[model samples]
Target: MPLPKPPVRRARNKEDNELLIKGMTCALIGAVVLLAPYLAKSASVQDLMRQAYLVGWFALILGCAFLGRYALRRLAAHRSAPRG
Candidate 1:
């Protein structure tokens, strides 16, 4: 008699999902900050926004990095799975 194959587990990783959510949030915040300057009419507010432009860039880059990491992890997991 042939042996039975083990069942595959499709458990989801909470941490990975959280990371994805965080990334999305950061990206949204960064976008808002970057665009706020264009919408502001006051010179003072525009100046402040311009000064904080670097912060927006940082947040955007960080968010992209997190997203990239999540994607890489998922890809690695998929590649490591046993073939049927």
Candidate 2:
């Protein structure tokens, strides 16, 4: 049998970066939600959902913050690449 071709990589660009950040945020939040029931619940489903919402919000905010930092570092590296 012939070898299969590797999957094609998407172009790395601003739009892609935005998408990546959004995807990561969603994945992390979803993971938190899936585990919410297993976690400690105060009184009812309302409380549990409230906690989940707060946690999810923070997770996304932190993810975006780190993504922005990474972008800045990449920009700096690119600028300093040709040190002559």
Candidate 3:
């Protein structure tokens, strides 16, 4: 009897998956940083958190952009695929 063949994996698919994971991680980190001020009790800590607020926003925006790019690529690929 012949052995079962393994599933094929494409490089583009792997890269797309990586992008999705990276975007999720960045968004999670940004959310944590953005909420840090509320969790701090010390005035100095809150002040630091305020300073880091811009960084959090940047990360969140970047993550959203990455997610958007991934979605667009997927949509384009789906649209271009031939129907049976």
Q: What is the number of backbone collisions in each predicted candidate, taken in the order shown?
A: 0, 0, 0
lDDT of 3 by residue, 1-71 (tens): 97675455498899889889988888888887899899999999989988999999989888888898889
What TM-scores do the predictions have? 0.76, 0.44, 0.79
Candidate 2 residues 61-81, lDDT tens each?
766665676677568657956
Best by lDDT: 3
Over 1-84, each residue of candidate 1 has an lDDT whose tens digit, in order, gives 978875654345776787799889888878878988999999999989989998999888888888988898789879987797
Better of 1 and 2 by TM-score: 1
In model 2, what is the error at residue 80, expressed in angstroms?
0.9
* Candidate 1 all-Cα RMSD: 2.8
- Model 2's number of clashes is 0
* CA lDDT of each prediction against the hidden true structure: 0.84, 0.64, 0.86
Q: Judge candidate 1 against the unseen true structure and give its global Cα lDDT, from 0 to 1.
A: 0.84
Indicate the worst ten consecutive residues by lDDT in candidate 1.
Answer: 6-15
* Residue 10 of model 2, lDDT score: 49
Q: Judging by TM-score, tell me the better candidate of 1 and 3.
A: 3
